[model samples]
Target: MSFFFAALCRTLSPRKEEDVAEDYLSRDAELKVKSQTALHNSHDSVKLIKFADDTTLIGLISNNDESAYRREVDRLVSWCSGNNLELNAQKTVEMIVDFRKSTVPPPPPSVMDSPITSVESFRFLGTTITQDLKWEPTISSLIKKAQQRMYFLRQLRKAKLPAQMLVQFYTAIIESILTSSITVWFAGATVRDKQRLQRIVRSAEEVIGRSLPSLQDLVDSAFYGRANSLTCAGGKSPAEVANTACSHADALNVFRHRCNGKKTCELNSPVFEQDPCSDTFKYMETSYSCVPATHRVVCEHSMAYLNCAAGKVIKVLGADFGRRDHTTCAFRRQKSEVEKIDCTNDAPFVAEKCDGKNTCELRASQAVVGDSCSNTSLYLEYAYICTDA
Candidate 1:
């Protein structure tokens, strides 16, 4: 059973200034969810999801054993009651997503002595989610909301409003609805469902007498950099605007440098050495994935060998040849030597040498990765993953 509850940089002139700034607002939700998750030590078979005031419990029941799930639910109810918070059993719902054939519906768990409602689908947050996990209900709801907003765009057009204003209106009202939580459902949406969404954009275009960015374009080029947790976690970020009118070839290098292994990052526009689209208004657009990697540490003046099992090859993610901390190569090193911890030299050479190879050796010496800080001990710290040969 599962329960559902709902919840930019500007660069200056040409000299390629690479200064990273701190971002606190973007880290709030991720940190909140993580902290809350740590507080609840439920059974391994049960998962708890909490967002704002909403709480959802998902259980992996095997062999008709739901003891863990029920125990967690009871604990949640007890927690709420102890906190002087009353749960609305009438509003609470449970939906089981079982794929096995010839199975019976699971018993409903009670909340506050009243049986919780059982729903085939429920609106969690703003997106409508069903047991089957299909996206039609969510998409259809969006289409209906967008179609209703399109009527206002038609009225604005009839008033002889400027094209720019009409476009803004459509984007603010209609487009927002059509793309709400898009990253969750768009990729899995069937071709027919995607078309239903695009039709709304097309309808708004007809009303405003101007071409708007298609749904696909909006999804593909929504935002650049790891602005939020979702964007970094392979989900589209609706907070940032899309600027497909411009493109930058060095975006990969800049982003990889600042955000390759970090959880959260921010970049200014000046990071781009040469702005590809200078004349048009521009914003960065990119997408990246978070993968599990293996880390290797090698002290300076030593060689580190990276290897993979049979039928597998190495793929380097990112590496640094200089020491960033005192603990890395602190063995038999002077305090002054290890104190220069700000050193970090790019290790692109490592990637070039080890990528796609089954086994490789890396020498952590000045000859290979130059000493960024003089008289300081350095180490080569790199991360990589193995893939099929």
Candidate 2:
């Protein structure tokens, strides 16, 4: 009799639970509904994903035609009004994702006369995404957030916490942020960006008074077939190692351009063979991922000469060695050689002198290049482009 009663109770329980779930679903549907619209004669559709009180609309705008998106925004606003739900204009934000060779600027989208702010990058669903699809911004943000939590880690250190407990705390709090979306963004992160992110982990290791494996090492350990060898030049100081690594970032940029949209690409190929740093030490290295390239140019000029900073070579594009007019060649002396002396021919000489060195200083005095004109006090005016080695 007891077993029969138990069977009856179990059978009735599901029905009661189903009724309650059905009532909640109905109430939720009435309170919040998905916003949708058709475009181009229903060829394209905009759909919204509704979760409780939050709604996110997803759609495509071809040729930068945001008209459909604007219409949907208006529709959502109208629906909210009909449902007696207040739409917060201040809280509304929009992000544009463009993956074209030539992208058109999107016009400002507005709702209820308030212009929504467009962002180059924004945080959504715990991930930072950018218009250019680079992960530097997200890594930077994660580093900053992890750094803030370092203060607590310091306190734990001062409190004489056990090494194991400290490591656990860091793993639970700080490392969690660094590793949250690593799989998604790691492939597109530059070497410099990865090093910056790893520095935080190194700091935690230092604080805990124990050596810990890096994120890359952990990844390699997890995936047996994905390990790639990294070889550093022997006898390199820590600073030089960093600089060498930075030069590899250029290769990463090229890799991204070729493999970003492709379905598959070889991890080791001759396509990524350029050496930007021209380091004396050679290493057999391979990269398993791709990321956008970053370039920097630095120039310095003085009355005596011009110099290109280390890691750069000066390529003089054009120059005027003599006085032209007051406005044209102000650097020229009052008493100059000829009215205008073309320094275009001197580019080869300048390149020969400054090409390979870390810092190249070229003297503007007559000693380096014979005086073009005796009477006029001429000044050197020049423009040059710096190219990475």
Q: How large an RMSD does model 2 have?
A: 20.0
Candidate 2 residue runs with Cα over 4 Å from true position? 1-54, 64-67, 99-104, 217-389
lDDT by residue (tens digit), candidate 2, 1-389:
00000000001124444655687787774433323442122225455655445556655765555566567677666666544355566666676666656755556666568777766666656777676778887888899999999999999999999999998999899988888777678866778998998899999988999887687754422111111223443565544444433335454444443333233433443444665445333333333432222212111123434446677765554333433233433444353433443321132455466545445556555555555555544545444455576
The top-ranked prediction according to TM-score is: 1
Q: List the residue pairs that clash in candidate 2.
A: 332-379, 335-376, 335-377, 336-376, 336-377
Flag regions of model 1 displaced more than 4 Å: 1-41, 222-389
Alpha-carbon lDDT, every model: 0.71, 0.55
